[model samples]
Target: MTSTKTSLLGLTRAELESFAVALGEPSYRGRQLYLWIYGRRARSFEEMTDLPEPLRRRLDAAASLDRLSLVRDTTAPDGARKLLLEMSDGLRIESVYLPDSPGNTVCISSQVGCALGCAFCATGKMGFYRNLTAGEIVDQVIEVERLTGARLTNVVLMGMGEPLHNYDNVVKALHLLSDPKGIAISRSRITVSTVGITPMIERWCSDDPPAKLAISLHATTDERRASIMPVARAYPLDDLMKSLRRLAHVTRYHVTFEYIMIAGLNDRREDATNLKTLLRNIPVKVNLIRLHPTGSDLQPSSDNAIARFLDWLRQEGIRCTLRESRGVENSAACGMLFAQEPIRPSSTQRRTLDTDD
Candidate 1:
């Protein structure tokens, strides 16, 4: 748009309808516009074929698509594709497409870089850049879908930043993505992963149709969790668990606990027992992830350690599964994929394309 007009990419369906009515157009035009932007992945106002030519031209001058600029799209041999999406300000973020059987997943970032300095995460090591707007967040899904030519069956906000840190924008992006009039992905298929921000979890319980919740619960004890995840100090496990229990009761959903199995650190048999005790009353499922190597000294738990932990969890009646590693060779696996080029030169291969360009 000529005068720094806002991007329509991230607006909820209601907002689009309101915008259409404000433009002296019929309300149905909003749904049409919504379908064009997300359902059809329209890149420009001119691409909305159903709209009248005059209206399209008017929109061209007053609004913009402002979707992500694709920089580098890398695919590993395992059918996982990682995309480098350049923001208008030149900061970059990553989104990934994983072609898992029976379902394809697109993992997206909610912030340019992560504010939470988790000891084992490559993204947190780069430090915080800025919170991605709702538009930037949704564009990750739309662009990844276009790149892979497959509709995403599941969406995870688990790529770069902790979702709860950028709470409002991430929630807004969820509303936009799950809107049936637009992309129409079911809310049940969306999962928001956070580093256990307790207050935010409590807030999400009131959402009418909340996306499922996933916690990056890498440790069982408060002291141990704080060593790697500094946020745990501010929001301790015991305090966070109170809200988690309430969430399960109110939402009636099994909250996902994502535990990264780290070697010689969190892989102890005692840790699994402690974890089971910690989650005793909470309605939850556990995803045991092998720690992906990062700049930190953390190493993945050995196969024996992993199996022991999985077996223990199952024996204790905890629903747990080992998360399959993907895109390891392309540096797109868990805990990898940061936006800063220098910090992660290989996976961070990116260039900028300003919307004005």
Candidate 2:
């Protein structure tokens, strides 16, 4: 059964101090907790050796350090590890670890599934289940560190859900993750990807965003973007660009537009020119991603098509990069995270954390 006790995983240091004060302990105890839970990576109160035995016992009874149970773990040949984690209520989410050069990066989810039915994303096919708590979000980082034994130098909220849909919790988790007393990841190293939620983009810009922004711009025209991403229909491309222009002006970071190149769909030279016109005055970078298969009839752009597209953008003086697909063999690459087979809803409600069908 899920514990009724309070969970201290996502609490900020000030909140932790308040919790300690409420428990009749000095506020310093909370600061110590900040050290242990994040820095020392303590999983249980018993591991907090510096705390008093009686206080630890009291904490054990009144609080819980609940963790997502690892339901299934897969490692790609490229040393990328994908974890399907089961929450207290049995919902599952995927988090991935990519051991990149210069730094290690962890990609985490903000919600169980997704509501934005993006045609290329496997997670969106599952539909929206629920938003993950701030604790659940932060714990993905903690759990990844424990499982991989690698310090994550970068974080991306690009796993399963559109982070702006779960704005408050995502913002809280961002602060906690970048807090000096906590995981201490640099805000500049963190990026949040969205499928163009315009109002939320404005709100994020106004609130002094902690992480960088990446918006999915698979197609240059509104009609084409709406054809693939249903959310695009709600917020038109023109309005989205206006907000992005403002965001680019206000934020210190350059906006990144993620374009998925699909065969015979949006990879033509004309599309590249249209994209250039669309992002004319915006300070931005383009990341061209070859579409990864997810049971869709759509095929990836040909090598020559991608090269031409990249060459055209570079020739136009736009900063662009072609993202190399990693973890493709194990279904852990971009747009490939789903929890269908990993979660088993049976009479016993038991699930294994090993590789299985």
Candidate 3:
């Protein structure tokens, strides 16, 4: 298996320049190659027509550029499209492109499967597989651009796995996504969500952080949260809130809280009140997501229940929005991204790696 370090597509402009100089090519060659892959969105070396044939041959021989392949694509009635991407290693992941009034938004996955074990999520049930390389993540966005012929304005790292778990690669992907020479998408257009990984959040706030942060805050009470997301057992509500406070204070961005309304679970009026009390001092917006049926024990909150919950939050003066479910018919809604292929465990199973580095 060749490592990504040998791949040219994933390299930053500076890294590409260094590689080109090491190969005794002019510095301009690296910039040309960067523009070819990112600006021109070329897939194969042959497509880089501006580069001389000899240089293209040298580049191809030194490093391979091919990364992700679009295995399947499904469009929703609402015009949302979901893609099943097969990585070079044959590991599968999902990415979604949603058409909004402003522009299209692409939801990219950071890991193959999830290890968080959130009870309501289907990806969690699939177990952790492998972390996706930065190239793989960037390739999904490029593929979407190629298909739509329109620039993707917004990106949300809320797909199969928790992005904060795959911190380094996720951050690298963000940098590549926001690079001025490439996609040049503003950091504000990218939103990275996590299931409250405190240490990583703290580091992200202190270090170079992305534009927005969203926490998967399903429950207000620690006990209730622990029952649903196993991650809560490690970082409880109080601890998580402290970290969130630091993030908000440092970044000055109102964090978004994602609350999935499960019927007979956390949809009660009292739950709304508890949520308000819990988020009283934090700068936050609550996104109430209607639970998409994943054929699990969980059920979607009734329309009445969701309306009542939203009304309660409004009465309490909390900013809340009820997110409309998209692509439910295609299993592309929240908590529904898992490979449809049969799981065939390898003879030697790789140890599951934590995404929280």
**lDDT (CA) per prediction:** 0.82, 0.87, 0.83
**Which has the better lDDT: candidate 1, or candidate 2?**
2
Give the per-residue lDDT of model 3 (tens digit) for 183-240.
Answer: 7778988998899888888889888655599999988788788888877878878778
Model 3: residues with Cα > 4 Å off, grouped in runs: 1-5, 342-357
lDDT string, candidate 2, 1-357, tens digits: 756788998888898999999999999999999888887889899999999999999999989777888988999888878999988877899999999734999999998778776889998777667788998999999999999889999999999888888899999999988887788999999999998888888898899767999999999888888888877878888898999998988886789999999988898888878888989899899999989989988889999999999999888789999998888988889999987664444324422211110
Alpha-carbon RMSD of each model: 5.1, 5.1, 2.2
lDDT of 1 by residue, 147-246 (tens): 8889788998989887877778888888878877667788999998888877777788876445888889998888889899877888878888888888
Clashes of 3: 1
Please state the error at residue 342 of candidate 1 in Å: 6.4
Worst 10 residues of 3 by lDDT: 347-356
| Residue pairs in candidate 1 whose N, alpha carbon or C atoms collide under 3 angstroms | none
- The alpha-carbon lDDT assigned to residue 50 of candidate 1 equals 86
Supply candidate 2's per-residue lDDT for 143: 94
Ordered by lDDT, highest first, the candidates read: 2, 3, 1
Residue pairs of candidate 3 with colliding backbone atoms: 165-355
